[model samples]
Target: MDDEPIWDVDRVVALTPSSAITIPETTNEFVIKGNHLTLIKGNQLDGRTKTDPHKHIHEFLRICDMFKYRDTKNEVVRLMMFPWSLTGEAKTWLDELNEGTIDTWDEL
Candidate 1:
């Protein structure tokens, strides 16, 4: 059995690539607060129904605006935090993109 293939399934599994969005370097002292994550999670976009993508983005920006860090730009923060607000198929789609494909928020 050690040499046998199980159900003809491939031995190798495809992995999700690293995100193309570059997160800016931050000082060791910089920390994203729990409330910030909470806010973003609260307004998650699951890619269903009549949810307005533009409106969702605006709300996401508003949440990102609530926090500031001296070591990193606000745009960097938005890029780092945006992925936390997706669920289901939306998340799957993002995870499937090739690494280094998106270098900026505008590209995303």
Candidate 2:
């Protein structure tokens, strides 16, 4: 998810300019595997990051939430957080945002 400020799910993205998703403060750790995301909050957050080598998994998780939406098929998995639930459509445009890069972020 670029791991930059622009990777944000609210004020960071261009789409839904006026819309901002409110994530709970308890949130400190999150991730995106394919299209699905898993969030683990609480005091254990700091512990979560230390274990994962990925620079900004949380950003990816949040970005997934921002770009995530229901597809034409209306599969509940399309907009939910399950390992194989995501469509991978949002991450496709970046060519490599999940890899943590946004060289041309203006189009977001």
Q: Which of the numbered candidates is closest to the native, going by highest lDDT?
A: 1
For residues 20-40, write the lDDT of model 1, one tens digit per residue: 567766665677789999999
What lDDT does candidate 1 reach at residue 58?
A: 93
Instruction: Return the TM-score for candidate 2, rounded to 2 decimals.
Output: 0.18
> How accurate locally, in lDDT, is each candidate?
0.74, 0.29
Show model 2 residue runs off by greater than 4 Å: 1-55, 71-108
Native-structure RMSD, model 1: 9.5
Mind giving the per-residue lDDT tens digits that candidate 2 earns over 1-108?
A: 233222333433333322122222322333334333433121012212123323334543454445433331212222223222212332222332333232221212
Predicted structure with the largest TM-score when compared to the true one:
1
> What is the C-alpha local distance difference test score of candidate 2?
0.29
